[model samples]
Target chain A: MAVKDTRAEDEQLNRFWYRYKKHTLSRSIVLQLMVCAVTIGIILTLYPQPTIDAWIVIGLVTAIAIVSTIVATSIAMRPVKDLSSALVHISGEPTDLTPPNINDSYYSRNKLRPLLKQIYAIASANITDAEAPKSSIALPNISGQLNHTSTGIVMMNQSKQIIFANSAAPISIDSNGVRSLDLIFDVDQPIMEWLSERGEHDIHAEKSWRRIPNKLAGESERRIFDIHVSYDRGSEAETIITMLDRTGEYQPEDDDLDFIAFAAHELRGPITVIRGYLDTLNDELIGVYDGDQEELFQRLIISANRLSGYVNNILNASRFDRRHLKIHLAEQQLADIYDVIADDMRMRAEAQQRLLSVSFPPNLPTIAADSNSMSEVLGNLIDNAIKYSNDGGSIEVSATVNGDFVEVAVTDYGIGMPPNVIANLFHKFYRSHRSRETVAGTGIGLYITKAIVESTGGKISVKSVEGHGSTFTVSLPIYATVADKLTKEQANNTSLIQHSSSGWIKNHGAFRG
Target chain B: MPIKNILIVEDDRFIGEMYVRSLNKAGYSVDWMVDGNDGLIAARNKPYDLMLLDVMLPERRGGEILQILRGGAQDLIPGTKVVVLTNFDQTEQARKDMEQYADGYLIKAEITPKKLLAFIEKLAASS
Candidate 1:
């Protein structure tokens, strides 16, 4: 019975709409004809003795009158047309109806006020039906799950004001009772930047930040969070940021370390092939090139060498981070190690228009260190000197004996660091803000250099004056001093002596000396 | 004996060709294999003076081949020297295991053609 009543009401509405449109159209046509006649009558009055030009003027005025009347009629009938379409749309999809305000004066004085009232009644009923299930079932369930989830979620407006924050969000309300994203995240976090940069286009971005909050409930631990930011572009623009705590869940061995090692290993193969080809080319093409061509070939070899060094640095840095890097300290001739790398260093320095000079005192003692690691340390220091120095500035590598340690210093007359920059120089991924733009570096070179130096019971320090120059000094324990200490600690420790005789140990006499 | 005959087992064709060209230029007979299976077959078939084996290979790993050749009841070719040349940085245990069966282990990235020739010449002179 209800369905039949609805169908009858719809049919009546359609009939009323059709009749209203016909009445409006006929009225518009009559109004336009009257306007045209009046305009022609005025034109005729202005020119009683009508000539061909006067008749033409009357015809143009009549045409303009007809057009203006049609436009005005359409403008006046727009509200009634809207009402008819609103009714049709509501009948088709009642749930999407937006009821008109009955209290508005326009609707009150409208010719289709009854139709508007009918649509309003149907709209209210359908809206109630649509909202009932959502309020009863989905709202509570969503809020409950959001409150229980470990991951913190926050939604913000374009101004970065927190619109909605879940229970897991580490938020604090200010005295004004306003909760903001600033209270939950640090100022350095990229989430705030992302929110501020929100545009009409959608954005999806993620970053990781390490945070250490104050003790809460007697528990204080370092937490690493991977923050995900998503922006939705629409009339109601919003940004959603989610923070997933990855402190306990992060497994370096299973994830990024292995990937770094794998990638570095794979990269080494190609570098080897490239270097091999370059070497063969150098051998076969020796003495066949002019000065400029030879310089270019030399630069090519230097770049290949640098690439190989970067791969090694990445692998070693990953290994050092995991404490898997093994440094077998033995008596190593510092001269031999330096000699192996000096030619490459010289080429690198010359390529950049810098002079490199190596000076070592004769009869220098061997140092107790890993030859490969020592080479890396010296290479990193020299590479830094070459990179940081200005063109034509000379870089000097020299050694000095200081007590029981042999200090190898790499000095460059170029841009240097201030005390503040030097303070965090050894920290991993800490590149000085001043040099970050002008200099190209991975920021892990010094970190790995420091670790390797310390692992071998050596020390690395730097002295610099901003805009003048810098000097990096690495002091390694003399081989005899370290060996003596080891022998005193363990008289039967033959392994140290035995290990020192392996390859690259050119000075066996240093053990007895 | 001087290293007159050499076998190179490398997957990368460019690197293999480089080794072959350099070694052949230096008047050493060379056999290049692109995979571990062919390499092992060739090694078992004939006794080359020196075998340049790569660690990461298809069909069989350099470590497995080394174990099969050296861990057998009797040596396949008693005096043939095997040098493990690779770019892979093995773990401590894995390296130790491979080092047990190989005469020498070298990083490929650290050794150029000239350096490898020098190393081979030194190995030949020592033997």
Candidate 2:
């Protein structure tokens, strides 16, 4: 019966192709005759005089051209007939489907060859009812590939019995032939809840949980997972749950920052002890040391201070990375902050044999800032200036009132950075190749400095020329203006300060230094 | 109202000893506790003019101790000024909560022995 049906289908395909070719040929011939008639008429009109012999020659040439055009059209369209037959055969029976061999020169030059080959390849690959058993052989291969995947897959039937689970799945069959999701996940887990709530409906749901403490034996660290659940509530009801472990993907960067914060915290105790003892010795043994010894002692203190600054930078940078850096803004005098650090700055500059001068305009406006963090910012810039300068060049620390803001510029006659280096100077861990060897730095000072300045409603910028010098400027909002804005915001019942600690300023009298 | 009697609640031996030596040499009697529980007990047993508290400590945290002493029905040390001295950085909210009970907050690494002594003396004179 199948053979007879195939023969009948082939005959029908041939009949269809013949009718298509005949119709296309008749249309082409009629179109050619019309063109010939129009050309002859145009010639008669243009010359207005044509002999009988010239007319006969024109008619003969036109007839030959028309025949040749018909032949060319037929040849060009032969590929279509071949393609249609191939498609009919492919659609008829899988067993009888044979892919067309397009290696022949005729087909190789035809534009439809690639398309014909693609259809034949697809038809041959398709499995019909007779070849359905062959697909069973592919089931293991698919399961194997799924097993190799990192995503855990669990498929369950309507009765809640796990039908299939990949090796990555956190499930196991019990001795009593019981397999359930509860064996792997807690009953109250969000995944379980999601499954129970949405498993009976046709839907797709996705959820992600972060830093879930590992409950497995002997494992102390947390794990992150992204879960996707797809359910089909048809006659063959089933639910597919996929879990992707994202712990390894997110751990390295987080671990690095945590380690930095931990290490910085640990370093602070030793730094405190060292600075304390050094200062104690300096206070007790004053005037006992000779000039050179006193200078050496002073250098020791300076180095200790620099160490403390480095630790602060590491801590702040780590905190900034975790989005945990806190700044408390209040009215602060720039001169008061400078006065506290003037001695240290002078000693640092003098130690380098470079003159350090600071100038602040009289009646300079007070700025809104966290005094401690602002001190760090200024210290970092000055330290950079002292570090990068060639011996004996001067460094200037100056502040100016620029409309409702104060711009504090630290300029140094140092080996300034090129534009390329200056562009990446504020990026974390970005060190210029030129200064990496000659200078000792963690490359995080400027980053932390910029973070602190900007977090307190300010901006930091740099101007540098490779051979000349670099000036780092910090612009901060004036206190009265910030206070005025804050008061207005408070009256409007809007939150003026983003940082929680800044709320202390509500009782402004207590913070008045 | 001189800060002659002081309480130093610090876990690190070296840091605690440094403060004790500096304050003692500066003519103030210093009581140093290495554990948070011991420090709280000492604060309750005797009155101190000033208390230098470390935030992270064994047995209990300085913040917890401060909350207990200050948030209780009775003020254990009415005139004692509490200062949080630690290297551990606090969040803004934590610092704000601490500022309510703390007279001062200072980073231990940022202040030298001499500076700390001077600061305590100033607090003493002001009080």
Among the numbered candidates, top TM-score falls to: 2
Worst 10 residues of 2 chain A by lDDT: A499-508
Q: What are the fnat scores of the candidates, in the order listed?
A: 0.50, 0.52
Q: Interface Cα RMSD for candidate 2? A: 5.4
Error of 1 at B18 (Å): 0.6
The candidate that wins on DockQ is 1
lDDT of 2 by residue, A298-351 (tens): 999899988888888888887776567767666778987676667788889999
DockQ of each candidate, alpha-carbon based: 0.32, 0.22
Q: What tens-digit string does per-residue lDDT give for candidate 1 at A1-513?
A: 999777756644345555677787788778878877886777678768788987787688767777777787777876766686676565553333344555667766765677777776765565564333223333333455477566777766656678667876667789999985432232133466655565545444444443312122113443445566666543122566677765465433224545766688888878988988998898789889986999899999999989988887888877775567767676677887786677788889889999998999988998888777778789999999988889999999999999999999999999998998887787656688777888888777888898889888888899999999999999999999888776564444334222221121111221110
Each model's iRMS: 6.5, 5.4
